[model samples]
Target chain A: MADAKPETKPKKTHQERMARKKQVIDERIAKATEERGVLILLKGNGKGKSSSAFGTMARCVGHGQKAAVIQFIKGRTETGEFKLFKDHPQIDWHVMGHGFTWETQDKTQDIAAAEKAWAQAEQLLQDDSLDMLVFDEMAYMFKYRYLELEPVLKALQNRPKNQHVIITGRVMPEGLLEIADTISDIRDERHAFRLGVKAQAGIEF
Target chain B: MADAKPETKPKKTHQERMARKKQVIDERIAKATEERGVLILLKGNGKGKSSSAFGTMARCVGHGQKAAVIQFIKGRTETGEFKLFKDHPQIDWHVMGHGFTWETQDKTQDIAAAEKAWAQAEQLLQDDSLDMLVFDEMAYMFKYRYLELEPVLKALQNRPKNQHVIITGRVMPEGLLEIADTISDIRDERHAFRLGVKAQAGIEF
Candidate 1:
């Protein structure tokens, strides 16, 4: 005992702690047994919310699964994602907004566009053939009162069993939050645009 | 003026507030004049860090730009991303780890693997031909002391001016944070895995 090195004790303790952590993680992994569709919400004033959704859509397409992208409040058709995925065989891409709310300035037109978009979304929600759907910037509809939250919530709840839904925007309503299987709130820690860097084509859009 | 209803006053006030917001946003947009590649850091204990990276990769490919991805600490070859992006013409994908640290448990081996990965990254950093590079799960190396921060920072600083770098993981080092032009902190508000929902193949992998 007297010959034992001081570092050995700490090393052993560290191993024990790691072992405990492993056990907990293993247990949690084992506990997760149910299999079904999930509603994932990506919100906050961050850079990657839409990017994350697109990435997952790519993954779904990679798996040979059918997917659809409904872009609200982003009317531009020249975005890199739109250009790439618009004609993809397994993807249905739609740009449904006139533009940003401030740019539109016409509440009636914005509401009409949102309603038309939601009408398509409502139909898509019932589509079991589609493995995934990306409701890009859908939260703004709720935040701006463009669409009723109840019907959207009900449609989400009643969607096909194995179809995953990904919603991305800057704000999330409480009703959507309650039913979300996963919620990722991306915080904006820093942005290049704030530092006098122009929003480049492939990076920002 | 005396005939104006209470709601009309609020409506005009709202428009004035929106006008001010639009001016601020326009001024900020105009102020950003510099154009260059960005170093984006995606960190925090949340999902979609790698997803966001891969999404941007797709965007880059959409624009006909070359990109590379170096995955650290994820050893699985059957991931959805690997299966989809590995064969892409514009993408150079490399997976360089035995497994998670807990699963490996060999400090010497992990360190060696990290070094090998960094060597490739260092070379890629100098390649102006590559438009973008993703060092996935790289922050763990710094947190675990498998790699030093100084050399990485220096390489990033000296990289091709038009080559963007994206680093993703749970914890970001101070050095990396300092150099990052854009940083997104994805917060885990809720997770399906914690609620007895199994990690699905396309969604979780």
Candidate 2:
């Protein structure tokens, strides 16, 4: 026991620890072999929520799966994503063209725009043929009470079992986390904007 | 004062508070209007770090900016992303094709593979023509001591001023965060595998 060099850690311990960790992870991976649609929620104050949702959309498209996106807000911004997927056959993309709620300013108009977008989303949700749907900033609709949560939740519940739905926003609704199979809370610990770093066209838009 | 109801907050107070918040945000946004390529670090235990990086790459490509990806660890698996970008003219991608370290079980081979990949990455890093570069899972190389960190860090420090770099992985090195303009700590609040959900071909890869 006296000869043991406990103070100076050895490499073998690291390997052993990693091996054990890998074993547990491998088991979990093995157990996670079920194939089905998953509800993914990206919430909190972070830069990458919409980026993540769009990334997954690309992933879905990469697999040749049918995918659609309904932007609940900022629908008029000419994002690079719109240009990339605009002509792609595998993607069904829609933007409200009304811009942001604050910019629109009219409550009645905002409600109508949200309703129009929701109708498109409801169709996608109910379609058994579609593989994936992205509800971009849908959480804000529910948060602002522009649209009721029950109908959207009900649509999600009634969606085809194999259709994946991804919702991105800050401060998700009350019961969304419980229903989501994968949830990431992206905490913006450091933001360049706060430090006078501007949002680039390709990066931030 | 006598007519004021203490139980009901004044609407003007609410408007004034919101106006103050908006002013702060607007100031930050205005101050952030300066344009420069950022060094972004996505760290923590979450599912979408690499996906977010790739999404950025796609966004860059969407804007017609030249970009590249050097996947350090997960190079073998034919990701849906690879298929999507293989023929993309604006994007240059390289994968080790060496798979994971545990699977190879050869330190020399792993080091060699990492070095080969790093060489390509260095070329990209030094290329001013490339608007963006992604070192996918590059943090692992530093953590595992596969490649010397000093040289890589030097390359990053000396890279083109207008070039953007994004590094994705868990538990980044000490000095990395200081160099990063934006950092998102993606917390894995919930994972589907915990509930016996599996990684699908298009979804997980």
Candidate 3:
């Protein structure tokens, strides 16, 4: 008993542990065989929801796929994403909002803008040639009652089966969440803005 | 008294309300004038931490700025980001891990790889020419105790004043969080993988 090895036991245990872990992961990977487009919802108060969408769009472009972006709440065309992607042959970009809600100062005008944006979005939804679509900050329309959710949901449901969509915003309606294939809720643990740091270019936008 | 103008009262009230809101936002935006590099930590269990970083990288690149990415946990060079950005004139990319931890199966080698990756990261931190640096999944090293937190913290503190850095992973050390100017916690509300959907290219990658 005194001569029994101690280090070997731990080594064997470690190997066994790793083997079990690998098997589980491998099985999961194997079990997941279906390939199709998915609906991804990025929600929360943190700062990367739009950035993540743009990053995915960039990834899709990397694969030579066509992509489109419809900015539902932003009125500015000078954003970093717009500057970079506006003229790219692989990307189709649109800025639909007139401006921030406060800036517009009229409920009727805001509704009109949202309706117009949705019209464009509906057209894109019907375009099967597009591989991906990013509905940046589109949830705000639903939150502010600028756009009806039912028709939007119906359009999403009937969109091209292989067309991926990434929707980003702080306020997500329940219907969108219900249909999402993946949802990432970005939480704000801390922010430099609270510390009086200016939102700078190439970062905040 | 019954003849008093009801609609006029509400319209005036709305204007006053908007005026107050505008003042507050204007003050905040005006107060935040200082600009410099920031450390952003993206944590929690969700997809898009890396995607956010990549998106930010694209934004930075859009501004004609330079970026470098040191992927601490990814071993594959065939990822969509790599294919799109590998030879990009503005990006410097490196994949420093042997693969997932279970795939490596050796703590010694894992630690060694982490150390090597950190060494590259440390060097990049000192280079002011690189406008941004992304330490993808580097948190796993600190979580596993493969890399000491103090040295990394010190390097970050002493790094170029104008260089922005983004660290993405689920496990974040307190020191990193403490120094981070922005922190995004990505929570997984739902995942397609759990529903037997395969992780597809240009989306999962």
Best by lDDT: 1
Q: List the candidate 2 regions with Cα displacement exceeding 4 Å.
A: A1-23, B1-24
Scoring each candidate complex against the real one, what DockQ results? 0.60, 0.53, 0.61
Error of 2 at A52 (Å): 1.2
**Residue-level lDDT for A163 in candidate 2:** 94
| TM-score, one value per model | 0.93, 0.91, 0.93
Tens digit of lDDT per residue, candidate 3, span B5-30? 67744455444666677788888889
DockQ score for candidate 2: 0.53
Model 3: CA > 4 A from native = A1-13, B1-16
Question: For residues A2-46, what per-residue lDDT tens digits would candidate 3 score against the true structure?
Answer: 987777444465556777899999999899887777999999999
Tens-digit lDDT track of model 2 for B34-124: 6778888988898778888888777777888899999998855467788888789988888863766665556677789899989999999
Better of 1 and 2 by TM-score: 1
Docking class of 1: medium
Candidate 1, A3-97: lDDT as tens digits: 87777444554446556777878888899999898999999999999999999888878778899999988999878888778888999998999
lDDT of each: 0.91, 0.82, 0.90
- Please give, for residues B60-161, the per-residue lDDT of candidate 1 as tens digits: 888888999999889887787888889989899999987876677667888999999999999999999999999999999999999999999999999999
The count of residue-pair clashes in candidate 1 stands at: 0
